[model samples]
Target chain A: MLTGQLIAAVTTRGSGASRVIERDLLVTRNNLMVFVSGFVEPVFYLFAIDVGLGRLVGDVTGPDGGPVSYAAFAAPALLAASAMNGAVYESTFGIFFKMRWGKLYDAMLATPLTPTDVALGEIGWSQLRGLAYACAFMTVMVVMGLVASPWAVLAIPAAILMGFAFGAVGMAVATFMRSWVDLDMVNLALLPLFLFSATFYPLDVYPRSLQMLTQLSPLYHGVALIRSLTLGTIGPGLLLHVAFLAAMAVVGGIVASRRLHEQLLP
Target chain B: MVARGLTKRFGELTAVDAIDFDVHTGEVFGFLGPNGAGKTSTMRMIGAVSPLTGGTLQVLDRDPATDGAEIRARLGVVPQENTVDEELSVTDNLYIYGRYFGMPRAQVRRRIPELLEFAQLTDRADDKVTVLSGGMKRRLVIARALINTPSMVLLDEPTTGLDPQARHLVWDRLHELTRQGVTLLLTTHYMDEAEQLCDRLVVMSDATIVAEGSPRELIATYAGREVLEVRFPPGHRYAGWTGLDGIGSRREVLADRVIIYGDDAEQLTSAVTHSGVEVASMLVRRASLEDVFLRLTGRRLIE
Candidate 1:
C-alpha cells in the first residue's frame, strides 16, 4: 500500500503518461515477435539449468544453507537477471531510438504530455513487461517443482521492483548517450552485473572483500531478494533489498525526467 | 496569444531576440523569414514546448512557464518535419495523439474519420503511415494536430517542400480551416504562401522581426505600386543612365538586373529607354510581397 502511494505521488505530475503506454501497446501489438524475444533469454537459461547444469552440479547450498536442487538455486537468480536485462534493454535501446531517430518525444511533448509523463510511462511499460517475464519464469519454476515456498509468489513483485529500478536508471543513462558508441558502454556495465551478481554461483565464491563489493551491485540485491523468497528463506533482511530498489527507482525517475525535460524543452 | 519582448537563447547564440507579436482569434497570422530567422524558435515558444531565455510570453491568456501543459492542450502544432507515427495506421496516429490530450477513446474515434477526411487520407485510413505520399503525410500531421480541437494552430513551414499542386491542396485545406473560425499561425520562407494565407504577418531576419503588416500595406510602404525590371547581359557592367535617378521613387541595382519602383512601370520603362541605355531586356510587373521582403532584408540570399 505504501509502494502504491509512492507510485501515485511520483506519477501524479502528469495525467498523460498512460497515453504513452497506450501508444507503445499499439506499436507492440503489431510486432509481437519482437516483444516475446525479450522474455525468452532467461527461459533458455532456466532450460539449461534444469536439463544440463542441475544434473551436473546435483544439489547446491541454497540461500538458507539447506540442500536445494541446482535448478531451484539458479532459477530465482535468472529471474532477477532477466528483469534487469529486459528493463535495461527496453529503457536504453528503446528510449534512445525513440528520442534520437524517431523524434517521438518531440511529437508527444507538443501535446499535454509533460517530460514526467514520458519518463514514467516508459519506465512503467518496462516494469509491466518485466512482470510478465517474472510470471512466466515463476510458472516454469513451479512446474519443475522448484517451488519450496508459497512465498515465491512475492518474487513477481520483486522482479517488478527490480524492473522499476533498472528501467528508470537505464533511462537516465540513455538520456546522456549521444550515439551507439556511447550505448556500447551499457553492455560493458550490464554484462559484469549479470555474470558477477551470483546468478550462477554463490557470493562466497568471491574473495571476502570482493563479496562485500558485489553486495553493492544493484543486481546482487535483486538476486539476494528473489533467491531468498524462492528458497523460502524469509527474513527481516528482505526489507533492506526492497528499500534499496525503491530508492533507486525514485532517484532514477527524477534524474531521467529532469534530463529529458532539459533536452526536450530546451 | 500575446508576447512582450520574448527572447530565446541557446548557449552563446540568441535564436529569438526581443520580438513581440500578438495573435488575435480567428486570424491567419504568419511569420515569414529565411532559415535561421528564429521563426521556428518563436513558434516553439508560443507552442509552449520551449521556455523563454528572458522576457514574457502568454499563450491562451496564461503564462507558458507555469501553465505550458494547459496552454499546449489547446494549441495545435504542425512542425516543419512531419513527425507522424510511422509505426501506426493512419487512424491510430490520430487516436494516440488525441489520447495524449486526455481525450476519451470514443471521442477520439468519432473525431478520427472527420480529420482524415479533412486531410483527404480517408481512403488510406487503414494503411500504415509509411505508405502515404509526402503531401498525404503532411496533411495527416495537420489532422493529428486538430485531434483536440485546438483553438489555435501553429504550422512551421507547412508547405516548404511540396510541389505546386500539393502546396495548393494544403492551402485550400488551411483556407477551409480559417472558414471554420480556427485561428492559424504559420511560418514560411515563401512570400507567396504568406501572401496567400496570412491575414497579417511579420517578416523576421537575423533573429528579429524587421517588418510587420498586411502584404499590401508592406508593399505600398516599402516597394511602390509597380516595378520595372531591366536585365543586363552576363559580364556586362551596369550602366547607370543619368535619367535613372528621376524615373522612379526608388531604384535598386543588382549584378544581373536593375529594378526601379514607381507608380507607372510603363512611364519608368520609357524613361529608362529614352536615356540611350542599351538594355538586354526589360519588363514591367506589379510590386509584390517578394519585393517588400527583398527591400527589407537585402538582395543578398541568406543561407
Candidate 2:
C-alpha cells in the first residue's frame, strides 16, 4: 500500500511537470523573440571577457599550471557562469513574476497540479534553457580552440548539473521574496560569485584566506568542474566537485518544492 | 459539497467564522457578502486551495485536506482577478489551462472551438489576451474554467469589475452552464446578481453567515413585499413619525431618507402623504434582496 501511494504521487508529479513544460512551450511559441533573447546575454559576456578583457590580461595559468591564452582559460569558466546565470535568472525572476504578479501558479493549483509539480516543472524548464545555452557556449569554445581535450564533451552534462544546482537553490530563495526590491539581493549574491569564482583570473591571485572563501561559493565548484573537464586535467579530486554540486541539486530541489507547497497551498 | 462549522483564521483574525452551508449538485449556490466578508475565503476552501482551519468540509465526497489534488481534478475555478495568461493568445490560454488539467491535446483542440463559441470569443481566438476588452477577458476566463467539463465550478466575484454589458454576457454563459446540469458556486456582493442567478444563497457579514434562503424567501421574511422611501429636507427632524408608524409594518430612519416597509407600497405612500410629513420626495418600490441584507446587517450591501 505504501508503494502504491508512492507510485501514485510520482505519476501525478510527472503529469504536472509535463503540463508546465507544455504551457512554457505555448508561451515561447508566441514570444519567440524572448526565448531567443536569453542567448544574447551570455554571448555578450563571453565576448567582453575574451576580446576586451583578455587583450589587457594576456595568458593565464591553465588547470595543469601551464600557460594558456587568457580566452582559453576564461571560456570554460564563462560557460559555467552562463549555465548558472541561465538557471538562476529563469528560476528566480521568472518564477517570481509568475508566482506573485501573474498568479500563474494560483491558476495551476486550481487544477490538478500541485506546488511540488510547479517547482519540478519550473526547474526542468530552466535546465532545458541552461542546456541550450551550454551547448551554444560549448560550440563557441571549440571554434575558439578552447577545447584542449576530447574529454571536454563531458562538460555539457557538467553544465547541466551546474544549471540544476543553481536553479533549484534560486527557486528556493525566490519563494521568500515579497517585492521587486528583494530581487536586488539575488543580484547582490550572484555578482560577487561571478566575479570571485576564478572566472576573470586564477584563484592563485587571491590571498590564502580569500581563496578559501572563493572555494566556498557554489559557483566555484561548477567553474572548477567544467574548467578541469575542458582543459583535460582529469583527477580523482574532480569527483569531489561533482559530488558537491549533486548534493546541492538534491537538497535545494527538496527545499524549493516544500517551500512552494507551503506558500502556494495556503 | 458540505461545510459544517467551517472556519478560516489568518493568524489571530478569523476570516470565516464557523460557517455551515451545503451545496447540492446542479444548483447555483451563492455566497453574498461585501468586501472582506469572507466570501472569497469560503470559496477558496470549497475550491480546495485554502486549507480549512476548523470544521468538517467535504467536496465531491472527498476531504480537501488529504485529497486536494483529487478534489481539484474534478472542480473548475474562476478566481476574482483576471488570472488569464496575458502573454498568450486566447486560444493558447484555454489550451494551456486544459493541459494543466491533464486533458489530451487532441481533446483540448476539439473543445477550444466550442468553448470560444460559448464565450463569444470566436472572432478573437488568435488575438493576445492583453488586447481583449475587460468583458471579453472575463468571458474567456469563464470559458477556460469549463475546459475540463468539471463536475463543479467555483466563481469568486465573477463579475466584480465588469461593466453592465459584459456582466450580462458572463451571466448568460453561466446560466447556460447551469442549464446543462453543471453545479456552480459563486460569490458576489451584488444583491441583484444573487437574486437573478442563485437558486439559494447565504448572506455573509463580519465573518459569519447572517441569513440563508432563496432570494424571495429572505426578502419576504426580513423585508415586507414593498418599501416606501420618504426624503424630507436636510436637517428636518420629522416629529410625525408616530403618525406614519401604523402605515407600514416597520420603519428604518436613515440620514438621507426614511424607509417604510409594508405589504402594499401605494397604500403606504398615500398614508405617509396624508400624515403631513412634509416630504421632499416619496417613492415606493418592491422590496429586494438589498433590503433583506440591510435589515439583517444594518449596513448597505455595497458600502
- Please write out the lDDT profile of model 2 over residues A1-266, one tens digit for every residue: 53354357667578788789878877888788887777777778778877898899888888789988888788888888888988888888999999999988899989988776777677777777777878888898888787998989999999999988888888899989999999989999999999889887888999999999988899999999999999999999999999999989877877787788778877
TM-score of each: 0.93, 0.94
Number of the top TM-score candidate: 2
Per-residue lDDT tens digits of candidate 2, residues B205-243?
A: 999999999998999899989998888766565654445
Which stretch of 10 consecutive residues in model 2 chain B shows the poorest summed lDDT?
Answer: B234-243
Candidate 1, position B194, lDDT: 90
- CAPRI quality level assigned to candidate 2 from its DockQ score: medium
Q: Give native contacts recovered, as a fraction, per prediction.
A: 0.85, 0.85
Supply the DockQ value of model 1: 0.78
- Report the C-alpha lDDT of model 1 over B75-139, residue by residue, as the tens digit: 99999999998789998999999999999989999999899899999999999998888999999
Query: Which portions of model 2 miss their true places by more than 4 Å?
Result: A1-12, A47-56, B237-247, B274-276
